[model samples]
Target: MPTLRDIMTPGLVTVDPQATLKEVATLMLEQDIGAVLVMDGEHPSGIITDRDIVVRAVAYGHDYGTAVTDYTTGSVFTMEADTDVQQAAREMADRQLRRLPVTEGGRVVGMVSLGDLAVRTGGSADETALQGVSQPSADPQ
Candidate 1:
């Protein structure tokens, strides 16, 4: 089995906690990614996903210029770069998270998604990564 460092996308794009939702959305679009790591001066602070924009920003009727810190999900779950793929998958399953940041010494290094795990574990579909996992609450608070 491959280590997370073997399959994770390195040099991930990150955003500031104080950045505007509009800025985050634009960065997502520009990067062609579904999520962005939120950083506090090089330390991982939180994460902002596309769902966050739709549910927390759009659905809540908050302006795009709203601060991302106001809507970002903090207390992010992370994994070390050298962690075994199975362990990483299990952690994601336990947390009911679709994505997990790969870190080293409290700094963001990369990110892993359900698709990445499925591909590594020989699962049929990326969606199967969520199997045997509890569903996380949709509420962002």
Candidate 2:
């Protein structure tokens, strides 16, 4: 089984909690990533995703200049870099999350996404299972 360390995208883009939402948005766009890990010192504090920008900010009419920490989901779900990809996938599914931060010794090292796991596993087991059931039944005659 592949480990998160093998599939995680290292050198992940991170933002400080005190940074403005606009600054975070610019960083996301520039990095071409959908989410960013928010750090306080060396520890991962929260995460800000594109959906947060829409639902937590624009949809609610919150000002973009406001600090990102105001809108970020501070209760982060994380996995160790050496954790099995299957375990990470299960955790993400259970938590209904698309991404998870990879950490080592309380320090953020990288990030892993559902897409990355799917690719690394040569397509998800769930997908393969669904495909198996979706296939046509054999003729009874």
- After superposition of all CA atoms, the RMSD between model 1 and the true structure is 2.4
In the range 1-141, model 1's lDDT, one tens digit per residue, is 578898788879898788999999999999999999889897878888999899888997888888899888889889899998777877777677888899887677999988777776576334445873547556534
Error of 1 at 103 (Å): 1.1
lDDT of 1 at 40: 89
Off by over 4 Å in 2: 125-141
Lowest-sum lDDT 10-residue window in model 2: 125-134
RMSD of each: 2.4, 8.5
Identify the leading candidate in terms of lDDT: 1
Clashes of 2: 0
In model 1, residue pairs whose N, Cα or C atoms come closer than 3 Å (at least 3 residues apart or on different chains), thus clashing, are none
